[model samples]
Target: MRRYAEVKTANMLMAVELSRRSKGQLRSYSLHPGMVATNTVDKEALWPAFRQLDIVTSDMKPKENGFERWKTIPQGATTTVVAAFDPRLDDKAGTYLVDGNIAMKEQVASHAVDPVCCLLLE
Candidate 1:
């Protein structure tokens, strides 16, 4: 989660810089699709953690899990698709998105608003 946050911070910084450099001709976004079910469990090294989480949270799974029990591939693609093609978001530049909506500013890091700090990360 820390690494994710760091990457998101860097991404937000890049988005801001790119947006400025492009003179409003570019739109960049950082986003997460929640816990989507993918072959990562079998192909990557996160299976042990995922398996343990599943065992612990199985009874707490909600009906909105995206499929019979877990998040589907399509569900994971929704936010990316929206961020890329949503006309309603024409003015939303240098933003973080989650579940197809703009993420709260507080959810991003302070560095995201500081070009100097953002550059330091690079």
Candidate 2:
């Protein structure tokens, strides 16, 4: 999680710098698909524990389950599309987005910002 966050931060910073240097209207954003039908849930070690926990919780609906939901892809895509194309977002650089909403600012640890991980984002 920390590594992923760092890579994302670096990518956003890079986008901000690139837009500034080019004098173009641009914004940087990030998103997480809450739950979509993907093999990652079945295959990723990181997700199974959470998936099992969700199953155990009666209040956790199938729509909320990462492995079961199909509608989330389109819903999740909206956030990115909005961030990229919405005129209201113009000049809003260095913003983190989640689930189509502006994300709260948080400090990320330096160790997570591995150059190798940052390069992967490129």
The CA lDDT of each predicted structure is 0.67, 0.54
For candidate 1, what is the TM-score? 0.70
Per-residue lDDT tens digits of candidate 2, residues 40-114? 444446554545546323433344444444445678577788787877667665455656665544533333233
Q: How good is model 2 by TM-score? A: 0.56
**Per-residue lDDT of model 1, residues 1-122, tens digit only:** 46656776777788777766677788877677767666555544654455455522343333343323456889889999998999877787767787788877776667675667656644
Estimate candidate 1's alpha-carbon lDDT, on a 0 to 1 scale.
0.67
How far off is residue 78 in model 1, in Å?
Answer: 0.8
In model 2, the runs with Cα more than 4 Å from the true position are 25-28, 48-71, 106-122
Which candidate comes out best when scored by TM-score? Answer: 1
Per-candidate count of clashing residue pairs (backbone under 3 Å) = 0, 0
lDDT for position 3 in model 2: 64
lDDT of 1 at 93: 73
Global lDDT of model 2: 0.54
Off by over 4 Å in 1: 48-70
